[model samples]
Target: MSEALAVVETAGTDTTVPAVSGARQFWRRLRAQRAALVAAAVVALLVLVALAAPLLTALEGQDPTTYHPALIDSARGGVPLGSFGGVSAEHWLGVEPQTGRDMFARLVYGARVSLGVSLGATVVQVAVGIAMGVAAGLGNRWVDLVLSRITDIFVSMPLMIMALALLAIVPNTFPRPVLVALIIALVAGWSTMAKMVRAQTLTLKNLDYVAAARLSGWKTWRIAVRELLPGLAAPGITYAALLIPSNISAEAALSFLGVGVKPPTPSWGQMLTSADVWYQAAPQYLLLPAAALFVTVFALTVLGDGVRVALDPRAASRLRVGTGRRRENRARAAVPENALPEKALPVKSLPEKEGPA
Candidate 1:
């Protein structure tokens, strides 16, 4: 058993487990950050709430449109505002100005639309980006050159202006908010992914693993996925996740400008729009949605930053300095029990080379 354990340890056959352990280590590092963990927990709970949003008010047919004026009209009715306007049970966050809509229910319902657009846009972005990236990556030199230049052209295009222009051209009947988001995101997403994939592909094209596979006569797509893609997974996940916030922001901006998700639908931006007329009279109505937007964006950005830091090889190297001495001590104690003696040589300047001359 001991000999088998030593063989397994020395032969380095459990390479696949490192991927799993690295993921575990990432979560462990994230957990070490108390604030980030709490923020992450809140984000998770929000995701759950967003998923069950339909059940919260759907069965009885309650929606953002559900208005209760008599309760809202009272100075201290069932709806109460918190510190923003003082807590009330009747219409939490108070009622919308003049309309007396249940801001609480509307806020909850808005989660669906906000999350839907954000997620849907992200899905489209990742799909289109990955396809474009992979195509640009696999193409010949001239193909890569032309594709890259096209990406640059799109990069130079004014995104918001383009979305507005495209929306105007595609009749309002056809350019629904989701379609608008998909189009705008596709343009931005493809360009960004193409550039990144090109750079990565250029670096990876000659990597030992990919080269070995290619030399073995593996099909191009098989080598691309089996060897090249695993290396790209870290960046791919991080980038796709980060792009979500941008999509959400675009949705909100378009909604604010009256070109986004149609009104009457519960959306963060549309929710805020309802208060545009009397922000002074009913500040809670506006502030709540805006705060929600800010928190969601902030959480996603920080989470993305954390993933980038953890995924980076250089960042992972920091663990050595912090834990090196302890590991060294353990190895020293275990040295006598092993067949080979450990040396005190510096790694970067190893003095010995074992080979036939």
Candidate 2:
């Protein structure tokens, strides 16, 4: 028993585990995160719906904007709500106020706006933030100073109030939903991502890879594009993925405030707005849009969290951050020199009891 215990202890202390590549390990961890997988699937479904919104909402060859008197009066109009008295067979979501449009079809069409705004805004935000952060981290003293001050200014401001005011002015000129999303993104979405990118770039700028690239006469832009940016990829992707929900909420808030996508445009927020007064009578109307928004935001948050955990450089680290390499070497050093366990050495049968013999 004593020998077996000693052998078990020795085996447990060995550290001959295989080390996988960082990228492959990250992917493996991500695939294991069930919440992220489900969220990704949900987001993919929404993207598909956004792409097919036109076909999804098509009613008798009429587009979502087309107003049909019979359809409207009968709760089949392309609206974003259904009537309260009796659910319409054709318009599962019901009819809109006064217009009596088919709410289901409009809701179907509304997916395009929600997804378009969220995705486009995120893209714009990432692009602007990446440029700003790269510039700041590339050792531009004056540029860093200016951008830092700008970031601080926005950080101090109330983003929502500013977004609403801007939306009121901006949507009138640019009726395009994507453009409106882009504008909102430029104002609100860029700051956080920019700060993150700048911090990351600052850390990575002095790395040996960057030094090698510079020594090889690589241009600043090429280094940033090829070498530095890949280092930023994991965090950037995580941030951008989470940024979609914020952008979506911003669009919804704008719509709720009556400045988003104008009338006749179907949107999750618009649907909620129209149902706010009627929620007491029919709660489902409000619940639908609210639920959609909830799912979108929750999904993004989950995906971001999973990504952070999966891509964490210290995912395998049990030691302190700076002590990682030393700990790894120490672990290797702690491994047993013998391949066989001490107990497995034929258990020395008490020297075959030679004394008794």
At residue 223, candidate 2 shows an lDDT of 91
RMSD of 2: 11.3
lDDT string, candidate 2, 282-352, tens digits: 56667777888898788877777777778884554221246667767887778876853566445455554
Candidate 1 residue-wise lDDT at 323: 68
The lDDT for every candidate, in the order shown, is: 0.70, 0.74
Identify the leading candidate in terms of lDDT: 2
lDDT of 1 by residue, 28-140 (tens): 77665555566677678778878887786564345578655654436643332344443364444556655566666677777777777778877777766666676678778
lDDT of 1: 0.70
Score every model by TM-score. Answer: 0.76, 0.75
The candidate that achieves the highest TM-score relative to the unseen native structure: 1
